[model samples]
Structure formats: structure tokens, C-alpha cells
Target chain A: MKSARPDSQGHFGPYGGIFVPETLMEPLRELTRVYKVAQKDPAFKKELDYYLREYVGRPSPLWFAQRMTAQLGGPKIYLKREDLNHTGAHKINNVVGQALLARRLGKTRLIAETGAGQHGVATATAAALFGMECTVYMGKVDMERQALNVFRMESLGAKVVAVTAGQQTLKEAINEAMRDWVSNLRNTHYVLGTAFGPHPYPMIVRDFQSVIGKEARKQILKAEGRLPAAVIACVGGGSNAIGIFSAFIKDEGVRLIGVEAGGLGIVPGKHAARFAGGKVGVLQGTKSYVLQDDDGQILLTHSVSAGLDYASVGPEHAMLHDTGRAEYTYIEDADAVAGFDQLAQWEGILPALESSHAIAWVVKNAGQFAKNDIVIINVSGRGDKDVQQIAEWKKGQSTK
Target chain B: MKKTRVDQKFAALKKQGKKGFIAYIGAGDPSLDDTVDIVLRLEEAGVDLVELGLPFSDPLADGRVNQDAAARALEAGATFDGVMNCVAKIRERSQIPLIFYAYLNTLYARGFEKAMNEAAAAGIDGFLILDMPREESGPYRKFISAASLNSIVLITPTTPEERMKQIVKDASGFVYCVSREGVTGVRDSIAEGARGLVGKIKGHTRLPVALGFGIGTPPQAAEAASFADAVVVGSAIVNKFHNNPHTPEGRADAAAFVAEMVKAVKAVNSPL
Candidate 1:
């Protein structure tokens, strides 16, 4: 079934569209055309599916959180184990698809932006497999926090360029990546890290990443003999959340909940809570719910995890919020820290801080659900890259 | 309704057999007071028109120079009210054509109707939103047309001829022809694509076609002026003010740079 989105001109209701310069318009149109052709070609589909299964290791286990579920004393919690994938994260799922698309487009090089470095590492891994030149743009500050992932990407034959612009974070890294993509459009393909940006990108990323939900739907039905009561995932640019949500969108029995980073608190400038604090505005390429000031200037966001430290979520998330099809909420840093610690102790699974935000929501709200109800949280990545930051955060908390 | 200064200036330039020069600078860079001084200096340097860039947080269409200029302006507390006030102050001194060059988001954030009334009151003659595609300019064009303000649309080298015909139909003051495919910046030579684009737009519209983006040096300006009705210089003048932004020296550098461009543009034996 065709998804209802991004009409002909690439607008998710009123949120998504091509707002880039004339330099990028033709390239975007070309990309859109290429993606459309690829969608209809079975050879393209067979290749993408083969990579998902053989290379990235598809259909990641839907492990029942037996200990955590019993301890919670209410709903049965199933963790969608995207952490078990190659590169220890679900990020490889989308990258593999985009890399194949890039190869078909005859692009010789790949460029991407990273905040937590999962996407960069994933893109670097795909580039190596495809024998394509790779460049990753990372914020200077993020490189300090995610140094290990930076090293990992470089070791995988990708040149990591440090961006020193505005706050030196995800948004700035994307700005630099965009500048590079515009300057080098002839031979380079920008492997956008998430389900954001302009037309075809958000739609394409969502389609590629939807493998998670398709597998989860089948796994849950076989294990529990029913659909999950609610499906929850952490939303930065909402790639993982939208990936899982799209497969279950038509199933009215399933509820989709997107958890944003609440950061420190719900104060004026402290949180990355877009629905609560943001307004509709244009940035980068797509127009979505953005955390901006009265004069349409973007505001900086705070989060414990670099991956979730963004000013806006995906346009589909905005559409979902507007349509009331999905519930958007936030879990603060302290709660996420507790979930990060408890999941390690209870399930022996060290979840990335980005994924821990989803765990935090389930941890806090599990008691409210019925005993017969089942919930699945997308554990998007393993916390291996976050070990140093987690240790530092623990030290900071103890010192206080 | 009063005749727009852009129209008046273009008519006079046609009679004198000279092309026009539109100078651009980010408002409130260093300070709003300095912006006023820069505009006055640019006018004094014989620039035919001016593009007052309202600072936006994420100007995706801009290159490094304008981006830094906006960051400086935003850092120094440049606001919508502040830009309008600067335009009002410039209006008090001269009747030079002024266009509000901004991103669509900044324009929408101020409430379209309210912003138009405020801009009209502040002596803004027109608008050019960098990120607004031709498809999304419907409501904005309506608002602009209602206010009798010119809504300048850009025609790029990549634009199809049929689309260019439709796009230029909404253009009131003039058609802005981007000299290159990339974002705004200073370049060594003009894009070979620009000359053909200017000629194409001319075949579609009776309105004056002003070419801009990368016309930095005098020779480039003169070269652009030869085929185009007017030449618009942004990053080159902005780079000068951005280098010194503090004293009379920065404004002096900007004025000097614009004076050379103006002279080069005037030297063109305008076929129009």
C-alpha cells in the first residue's frame, strides 16, 4: 500500500518541502526521480533486501524483557533488539539502502553528518563495503564527546571533518555538510543521517528504515499472538520512531508514542521539547516544528545524548502530531540516566543514551498499562560508544 | 499610491543610458547605527538601489560572508523592529530604492499582514525571500501585490523557460537573475550560464532584469552590466564591512568597494 505523504511537491501536510537554494533544486529533483524509479524496480528491492539481511543482519530479535517486565508488575515489555545489528545500532539499516541508491546514481563519494556518530560510523561502514570515498562532518564539541566513534569512522576509511560553527553541534554539522553537498554535487551523494531534510529524503529514509517495524510486527504476533498495545521510540530527527511507526500506522489497535529529549527541564531554553515549545518554521530544507524565537531564529537545545540534541523532529512526526495519530512526549535527562542504569543492571543490555530515553518513558509509564497489554520499545543502538560519557555523567552525579 | 523608488530609479537610469547597482549588507552587523552609516555611505557612493538583509538564524542560501554577517547581527541583537527602524532612518535621509531581503521563515514569524504594514510604513519598496520557491510564494505575492509593494522573484539558469514565463508574471519591481547555481559569494569569473539566463528572462518579462551573486570585482560588474539591466553586488561589499565593522574605516572600505562597482556599472554602454 502506498503511504499518504509528501504529495507531488513533497509536503507532509504543511511541514515538509524543498526549501533549498536553486543550486540544489535540480539535484534534489534528480534524486527524487531516481528514488521513484528505484522504488518501482524489483532488482533494486532485491538488492536492498539482500544487504539488509546478509550484511546488516535483518530481523533483529524481539526479546521479551522477562526480568524487567515481571519487576514492572504490569504490562509485558518487549525490546525490539536493533542493538544486535552490525555496527551495534539500527543506523546501518538506513545507510545500507542509501548507499545502494548512491551507487546506482553513479556517485563516487558519500558525505554525511553525525551527532552521536552512529550515523557517521554506519555510513563509513557502508562506504567501505561499497568501495566509495566517504567524508563525515561532525561538530567539534561532539567530536570531544564522541571521540571513540570519531576514531572508529576514521579507521573505517572515512575522513571526519570537524565543524566549528554555531554551538558546534548536530545543526551546525548539517549546515557544513549541506555546504559541501552543494559545492560537490556532481560526484558526491549526501547520505542524510535521519528522516529529515527536504522532499524524497524524509520519505526515502522512512521507507528504508521501516524494516524495523515490519519485522517487529511479525515477531510480536508470533510471540504474543496479538499486536503491541503501544510502540515507542526515541525521536531526534525521528528516524527510528518513524521507521517503527510506519509499519503499524494502519493497524488501529497499535498506538505510536514518540519520546523527545526533555533535557534538564521544561523551562524556557533548557529542553529539546519541540511540540511543547516550538512553532512551525523553515530550516535546512524542510519546514517542520522547530524550536525558534519570535524572530524565527533557531534556539539551541540541551540533552544528555548528542543524538537527541536537535531543534526539530521529522516532518512526519509533525504531521502525526497534527493528526493526533501519534502521541509526542518527553522524558528528562535524570529519568533517562536512571533507565540507562537500570537496563544495564536488569537486562544486561547497555542501551545508548538515545535509546534510553525511550526506555525511560516505558519505565515510568509501565505501571499504568493493563496486565494483558504488551509494549515494545525500540532499542535503536548499543551503548558501546556512550560508555565514556555515561561514566563521566555518573561521576558528575556522584560528585554533586 | 506612490510610485516605487525602484521604478523611479530604473526609469531615470534608462534615460541616462546607464545600468543600476544594488548594494547589500546585513543589518545590525556590529550595530544598527553602523548599518545606518553603511546605507548612507553606499548611497553616497552612487549605488542605485540597496538590499537590506534581515538577519535570519539559518540562512541556507547564503555563503560564508553573509552567514557571518547575519551571525554578527543576531549576536548584536538585531531584531525585526531594529531592521525596520534602520530602514526608516535611511528613508529620512534618501529616497533610494530599498528591498527587504530575508528568508521566508523570518518573514512569516512577524505575521505577514503586520509585517507588510510595518514594512510599508517603514519605506520598504519590495521583498525577496531567498528560500521561497515559486510554488510557495502565492500568499506572500498576494500580500505584496495588495500592499502595492514589488515582489521580486529569482530566475536561475536551471529554471525552465515555461516556468520562467510564469515566475516573471508575479515580478513587480524587477526580476532577480542569480549569476551562478551556488549560494551567494564572491567569485573570480561570472558563470557562463548567467548571460544566457538574463537573455531568457528578458524574452519573458518587460520588467528590468538585475543580475546578482558573485559580481564582486569591477570587471565582473561591468561584464554583468553589459548584458543585464542592473548589477547587484552582495558578498563583496559585505566582506569589506564585515572585515572592519567597528569604525569609519569599515564603512570607508565598503563605500570604496561599492564606488568601484558603481563606476564599472556606469561605464557599461547600456543597450537598453
Candidate 2:
């Protein structure tokens, strides 16, 4: 069945059109054309499926969090075990797909921009598996906090370039990666880390990630004999959220919820909640809800989770918010930390700080759902990468 | 469409049988007032047109030099209103053709029509939005033409001949032919692909071509002017006086450097 969105020009309603310079227009067009062809090729599908199932370990489990469900005393919570995947995150799913497409496009080198460094590690893994040269741009601040992931990327044989531009965060890293891609368009394929860039990218990344939803939908039906009342995921650039939401979009009875980083509070410069504090504007390459001031200068964003620290959300998320298909809300840093600790102690599973935002929302709103209601939260990644950062945060909190 | 100052200046250059020299400077580099001084100084040094860069938070098409200039501008309190006010002040002294080199978000945030109207009211002659390609320029083109401002289009070395035909269909003012495949920066010598790109654009539209990107030195500017109708020098001039004291001597020194570029471009006599 053909989906009704993106209209060939890659617009989801009024969002997600190409907004890059003339130098990249031709290359983007070529990529779009090539991706369209690859989607229908049987050999392409067989190769991608083989790698995803055999190498990356597809069909991650859907475990019922009985302790959390009993303690919360509201919804029956089910956690999607994406953390069980190879590399301990869901990012490998999209990276492996793009790497295969890159090989098909006849390009050699791979470039990426990372925030918490999960995407960088995933890209590096794929590049090494495929015997391709890889480079990743990461903000200086992120490189300091997510040092382990940075080392992991280097250990995978990827060159990590530290970006020291504005705010020294994900936004600046994306800017640096774009500069590199512009300079090396001939031999390099930019493996965008999120579902937020110009056309074809948002669509391409979302399609690659939809496997999470496809698996969860079937698993829930067999496990519970019905669809979950709500499906929850955290929104960074919204790749995983859109991934799980894509399968349930047409199910009218199923509610989709996306949680954003509320940071310290709703105050300006203290949060990364685009739907809460942002207006519709163009940034990076796509038109979407962006955190900006009155004069359109992109605002600085703050999140305890480096993965969720961004000024803009994906364009499709903007469309979903406007069309009222999904309910969006924010989770503060303190609450997210609480969620992180709660999930570890109660469920015996460590979740990435980014995924804790979704858990935080459910913990804060436990009374909103009925006790029989089934709700699934996507465990996007494991917390092994965030252990030191959270330990330091806890030490500082105790001192305070 | 009515002839804008940009069109008139290009026609005037054609009549004088000399190539045009276009100068680019970030508004409010140190302050908005200093931008006025720079524009007037470049005008006095024989610049036929000026491309005023509107500061954006994330400039994907710019290199380190232009990016740093934007950072300085934003740090010096450069806003949309401040930049328009600077243009109004320049109109108080000179009539040199002026255009905005901007990204789509800066104007889209203020409402494209309202932004264009305000700019035209403040004496901006045209716009060269770096990221708005032909496919996404439908409504933007209408807004520019409705405001009676020239919608300047860019044709890069990577743009194929078939795509170039579609890009220059309704292009006004003059076509900007990028001298290289990369973002805005300085290079050692002119790329051989620039001449072919210009020739291809000429086949599509009668609009005068202005070659930019990496044309920073006087000899490079002269070489670019040998084939194109205009030569745009941005990063070299920006890097030259970027750290000078914001005094009369500083403005004069910047103007002296630009004057050498003007002399080089004007010395190139070629049939258009």
C-alpha cells in the first residue's frame, strides 16, 4: 500500500521540503532518485533484511514491565527492548540501511554528525562492517560528556572531529558536518543522524526505522490480544518516536504520545521543547517547529540528555502535532533523572537518558490511564554510555 | 516587472563598457553604523553594487570567514530591524544598488511578504537567498516580484545544463555563477568550471552573470571579470580588515584594498 504523504516533492503537508543551496540540490535529487529505485528492488530488500536480522539482531523483544506496572498502579506498561540490539541502541537499524544504500550509490566515504555519540558509534560500526572510511563531527561539550561513546567510535576506526562553534552542541556539530559534506560531495555520502534534514532524508530515515513499530504491533496483538492503548517514545530529532508511531498511525483507537525534554523549566534557553516554546521556522534543511527568538535567531537549547538537546524537531513530528494525531508533552531534567533511576531499580534495565523522558512522563502521569490500560514505551538505548555523566550529576545534586 | 536599481546599475555598466564590481560585507560586523561606513567606502572605491549579508544563526552555505562575520554581527546586536535600519541609513547618503544575501528562515520568520516590503521600503534593491532553490522558490518568487524587488538566482558549477534552464526561467536582476563547487570562501586560483557554467547560464537567460565564490584576489577578480559581467569579492576583503580598529583610518584602509579590486575588474574590457 502506498502512503499518502510527502507527495514526491517530500512535503508532509507544508513541511519537509528541500531547503539547501544549489551545490547540494543535484546530489540530493540523485539520492532521492536512487533511493526510490532501491525501495522496489528485490535484491536490495533481501540484502538489507539479511543484514538487519543476522548482523544487527532484529525483532527485539517486547517485555512486560510487571514491577513498574504494579508500582505505577495505572497502565500495564510494556517496554520495547531496542536496547538489546547490537550496539545497544535503535540507531543501528537506520545506519545499516543507509550504509547499504551508500554502497549502492557508488560512494566510498561516510560522514555523520552526532550529539550523544550513539549515532556516531552506529555509523562507525556500519562503515567498518562495509570496509568504508568514516568521519563523525561532534560538539566539544558533547565530546566531553559522552567521552565513552566518542572512544567507542574511534575504536571502531572512525575519525571524530571536535566542533567548537556556537554552543558547542548538536546544532553546531550538524553545521560542521554540512561543511564537510559540501567540500567532499564527490566521494562522501553524508549519513544524517536523524529524521530532520531536507526531503528524502526524513522519509528515508523514518522508513528504515519503522521496523520497530512493525514488530511491536504484531507482538502486542499476540501478547495482549489487542493493541496497546498508548505508544510512547522520546523525541530528539524524533527518529525512534516516528519509527514506532508509523505502524499505529492509521489505528484510530491507539493513542501516540511523544515526550520532549523540558530541561530545567519552560523558561527561555532552559528547554528543548519545540512544540512547547518554538514557532514554525526553517532550520538545518527542513521547515519545522524551531526554537528561535523573535527575530529568527536559532535559540540555545538545554537538556541533561545530550541526545535530546536540539533546537528543532523532525518535520513529520511537526505535522503530527498540528494534525492532532499525537499528543506531545515535556519532561523536566529532574523528573527524567528520577525516571532513569526508577527504571533501573524496578525493571532491572538501564535506559538511555533520552528514553527516560518518555518514562518520566508516564511516571508523572500515572493516574491518567486506567489500571487495565496497556501502554508501551520504546527503550531507545541502554544507559551504559550515560553512567558516568549521571554519577557526576548525582554527586553535584547531593552536594547541593 | 519594473526595472530595479540592480537592473539599472548592470545596464549602466554595460553602457560604460566596463565590468561591475560587487562588494559583500556583513551588516553590523562591529555595529550597524560601521556597515554603513563600509558600504559607502566601497561605493567611493568604485563598487557598482553591494550584497549585504543578513546574519543567520546557522549558515550552511557559508565558510569560516563569512560565518565568523555573522557571529560578530549577531554579537554586535544585529537584528532584522537593525539591518533594515542600516540600509535606510545608507540610502540617506548613497544610491548604490544594494541586495540582501540571506537564508530563507530570516525572512520567513518575519513573514516573507512583510519582510520584502519592509526591505524595499528601506531601499534594498534585491535578494539572493542562498538556500531557496528553484523547486522551492514558487511562493518566494511571487513575493519578491510583488514587492518590486529583484529575485536574484544562483547557478552553481554542480548545476547541470538541463537544471540551469529551469532555474533561470524567471530570474531577475543578475544570475550569480558560483566560481567553485564549495561554499563561500577564498581559493588560490579560479576554477576552470566557472567559465563553462557562465556560458551555460547565458544560453538560458539574457540576464548578466555575476561570478562569485572563491574570487578574492585582485587578479582572480580580474580573471573572473574577463568572462562574466560582474565580479564579487567577499572573503578576502572581509579577512583583510576584519580586525582593524573601527576608525577613519580603518575604513580608509578597507576602501583602499577594495579600490585595487575595482581597478582590476574595470581594466578587463570584453564584449558582453
What tens-digit string does per-residue lDDT give for candidate 2 at B234-267?
Answer: 9887887696777899879888989999999999
Alpha-carbon interface RMSD of model 2?
A: 0.8
Write the residue-wise lDDT of candidate 2 on A80-117 in tens digits.
99999999899999999999999989989999999999
lDDT of each: 0.89, 0.92
In order of listing, the candidates' clash counts read 0, 0
lDDT of 1 by residue, A1-400 (tens): 2355678778888788887765677778888889999999999999998998898888899999988998888599999999999998888999998998899889989999999999999999999999999999999999999999999999999999998778888998998888888778879999998999988889999999999999999999999899999999999999999999998999877889999999998775688889988999888888899999998888988898999999988899999899888999999998998999889988999999999999999999997689879999999999989989988988999999
Q: Which ten residues in a row have the lowest lDDT in candidate 2 chain B?
A: B237-246
lDDT for position B158 in model 2? 78
Give me the runs in candidate 1 sitting further than 4 Å from their true place: A1-3, B1-3
In candidate 2, which residue ranges exceed 4 Å CA deviation? A1-4
TM-scores for chain B, in order? 0.97, 0.98
List TM-score per model, in order: 0.97, 0.98
DockQ of 2: 0.81
Q: Give one digit per residue, the lDDT tens place, for model 1 in B1-272.
A: 45688888888988888999999989898779888888889999999999988998777778889989999999999999998998899889988899989888887888887788799899999988888877666666778867768888888776778778888887888899987767889999999978888998999988999999888999999999999999999999888877765677767876887898899999999765
